[model samples]
Target: MPLAVWFVAVVAVSFALAYLNSSGWFWIGAGAVVLLAGLGSGAFPMDLFLVLSAIFALCSVVLGVSPLRRLLVSRSLLAWYRGQLPAMSQTEQEAIDAGTVWWDGDLFSGRPDWGKLLAVPRPKLTPEEQSFLDGETEQLCAMVNDWETTQVYQDLPPHAWQFIKDKGFLGMIIPKKYGGKEFSATLHSQVIQKLGTRCSAATVHVMVPNSLGPAELLLHYGTEEQKNYYLPRLAKGLEIPCFGLTNPHAGSDAAAIPDFGIVCKGMWEGREVLGMRVTWEKRYITLGPISTLLGLAFRLHDPDHLLGSREDIGITCALVRTDTPGVNIGRRHNPLNAVFQNGPNWGKDVFMPLDWIIGGPKMAGQGWRMLMECLAAGRSISLPSSGTGYAKLAARATGAYARVRSQFKTPIGKFEGIEEA
Candidate 1:
């Protein structure tokens, strides 16, 4: 039925019910009818108005409140109804467009010639970055050809890894003093998107180091020595770093205690170094099973307040080597999502000096904040880039296949469905 007919029938029945003094039951059914008609109409939020009407009817029944009286009260349902009536008001005019044939509803303007739809302008690339992107594309094409033949996708090919490293791709966002490319955030996104079109695995591996590694933390709070040491290596890909944030006890809880054991009672003599045995069960780490360097976050149990006077405080970030004593590297698990490589990374009572702290010793209890900042920037690029690139590639592949493969005595591309009409 037409929306106007339904709405008229509803209002007529509601008036009859109100005249017969059966406002209670009548309002309920009338509100429901209005809500359904409004939704089907898709002209505005009619459901909200219906809900308010129902609330007013209920208030009148329970509190002996008249509809007019309810309207006078602050935050009354009737007030809500009056406020929303403007949203439903519409002027009679034809909202026409060049390619449109008819009005379907307010949801969308129909266009018979969809090809003529205006597209947003693509971003113009900078000169140096454009040159780099062209070079990378050629390099990646070569790599993909070799990868297809070799059945060896366990790790990046040496030449591919070398190419990325030589171009300072890993250090694009890292501080320039640390031998980084120091490219803008937009450039980083573009490069990652380009890589995603070719292979997702390589893109993620490159992203993890560039975005989530110790460089982000160092740039935020690392000591001069720590920044000097790690940033240069990270840019050169000499040190592959992974974030160790999620734990078995704290899957999504940022405030959970990680349970680091205290082996010795008294504080260490003649030094600010405090010793503890950290026992943790971590999982879902990007490079946990294979990282050479780890940016680990664990809870500290400072009894005597040696490390800036706190006990059972929140988590802290540490730059620990994977090869350190008592650290356990679990076997890599097949994630079923062919791209991101992740596995269990557990540790047993790992002891380290105070210098192991990211930013030397001052960056305690600030790991979660740092992790959020880095991961936020990382996600903005990684997922979107991969999805867009894959979609574009799939579209290209489908178009080519449709052109070559034929049906109905002609190439499928020649058909109305396949061809741009």
Candidate 2:
């Protein structure tokens, strides 16, 4: 964290790299000589000096001992290190494998390759994406008023809400055949940013469905039948969807959810069927209050060993109609007076057919992995884009207020304190 410590670490790495390549002895000669001269100077602070000394000492052992150096890279050493660790939970391992490790792996390795960072491809908008941004996106922003959306109507005007659905704004990520725009994630973020500048409520409304909702999960892990039935409906806004991962007790720690389902026989449409009686209490669901379809995450248990010998099937995701028996989808959460729909929903002993599972019976217990994988786009694109939008609005508002508001017959922006700010 300290500059001096970073400096020493970089130098130590330099020395280690020198020993690894050709002209290694000359590296030992010139770099080591210069390093020793600096250490002899005693100009650094005491704490920094100690750190430098410790690093140099470490470099000595690492470069001096051939066997020690070999052991550091040996597979046996890696295995031993792994064996000493505690068993990883599904959530822990899923989180670690969520996104790509390109830059993170390089930085953590202690010998970063600069070229790899420079080689990453850039993201740009396609012509259709640009045109849509200039056209429908702009029109949508013009149609919605932030004050009216939040305060007057307590939600986006009905016309604007319909416009959002009809325009396929919520279906940006869905494929074309599924009645969605199939836009790139970059375009999705851009759309959010533009809408965010005009209306915070609209930004969230569009963001939730495009991000980690039923559509995304279905796209990644849904069975062919599920995809065929749901994707088009979602893309066409026939169904408003919300995902319930955060329960009353588990918000940020989604994997620690206490909600559960028992896999057993059940009645469905006047017939006996193998399914689950799911019980969940989820709060802070972004669109729960008005969602026609709900995406639920809960631990699945097999006490009767119906599917296999395993008792715990880990976390499973399933699709449930809000109209399903025993489902309680009502009430609302007014977050910061924002008009976007958000609320709590829970169910008690609701029976769900096995086919309702996102990927059917075969993919039960893989819900956490699907969530983590889909989380990458939300983290990188949707949330940040809204933040970017608001940031741009803040800067513009600040500048305009400074120029228009006056103090003693002069613009407030001309004042010393205001100018400094």
Candidate 3:
């Protein structure tokens, strides 16, 4: 390029670069100029030197006797950005807050600390886990008959379901003190991966209790009284547990749930007690039809302001017995005849004690946070492991079918279309 044209282009680039607000250019330019002046001399024009110095100064402003040069973001532009964002709910906020800030910091910086990562020890399963995987896991897979589970029973066979409970499959995430295996997250994931391969129905059966049911909630947020009473029973499979979060209107958006509970006093066992009158309709709840205990999430209201001045306390989760008065259970929704105990459950004016709340009365409106923190584990482990198992099954089936499936005296595997796959 021509000298005059090149100089103008460089000047323009330097002017544009000023908005970036970096100070490194000052040190780099100064070092280069000092080194050049110290080296063997060649005739250099004063005009060129002056122009270069000007360009270097323009490269950065903060280093030029100015304490700060950070360009303040435009208020109008920021307002437009804020307007572009959708209204976030309490559940959404908790979801965002669930992951550690440092987790993203290293990743977003494009230079994750490999030394720190490597310094972290690898997770390994105990002897018990390996033994269980080799024994009960294989036994369960042997009993799985997809045709019978999906069509005839529309669920896992009675014995197979019982075997899952007997093996403590539902209690992997629970602590040892709660009569559970207290397996590490890695072991839990591996268990899901193994179970996912042979039977999706069994996988769902085991995963539901391990992932999102009352057991998990109780472990995380339940009061001491609640934990002592519920955790062991859940771990031992004495009580089948299912969480009711998806209302008909809410679907996957837990925040939009229209199901509600009103704080009031109700007659319980011949005594007037502080409690809530909850009404809810939840669909597609895994193990719902057969669950003994229901963990229900509902918007709580204090119309009488019994707890405080605020009328609307916010979303709260409460444990309700499936056999409670006005409780509706044991209904099935045939979801493509999938072999899992998935169905809808509802209740109208069902009364539960204030103590039934997951974290008791004080945790009212904190259900979303509890759910979010617990859900991160489920989302990471259960979903990915389930998908991995399904993909393996699909690939094996496709490969097997291609060998025999033929047209024009040539196997489908020989065809270009099939070959590409």
Clashing pairs in 1: none
lDDT of 3 by residue, 1-421 (tens): 3455544654665565565554666555644554345232433455665676666566545344333433333455578899999999666777677646644478887768878777878888789888988888889999986666776777788898789889888888889898998987888888888878888898888878888778888888899999989999998899999999998888957678999999999999999999999999999999899899999999999999889998887888889889998989856877776768888889888888899999899999888777877776779888788778878888988999999998999999999988999
Deviating ranges (above 4 Å) for candidate 3? 1-59, 62-66, 70-96, 99-120
For model 3, state the Cα shift of residue 77 in Å: 9.6
Candidate 1: where is the Cα deviation over 4 Å?
Answer: 1-126, 145-150, 248-253, 256-272, 337-340, 407-421
Q: Against the true structure, candidate 1 has what lDDT?
A: 0.68
- Whole-model Cα lDDT per candidate? 0.68, 0.87, 0.81
Give me the runs in candidate 2 sitting further than 4 Å from their true place.
Answer: 1-84, 104-122
Compute each candidate's TM-score over C-alphas. Answer: 0.64, 0.83, 0.82
Between candidates 1 and 2, the one scoring higher on TM-score is 2
Q: For candidate 2, what is the lDDT?
A: 0.87
Candidate 2 vs candidate 3: the lDDT winner is: 2
Provide C-alpha RMSD values for all models, in order.
Answer: 13.0, 6.6, 5.2
lDDT of 2 by residue, 168-251 (tens): 998999999989999998899999999989999999999999998999999999999999999999999999999999887878
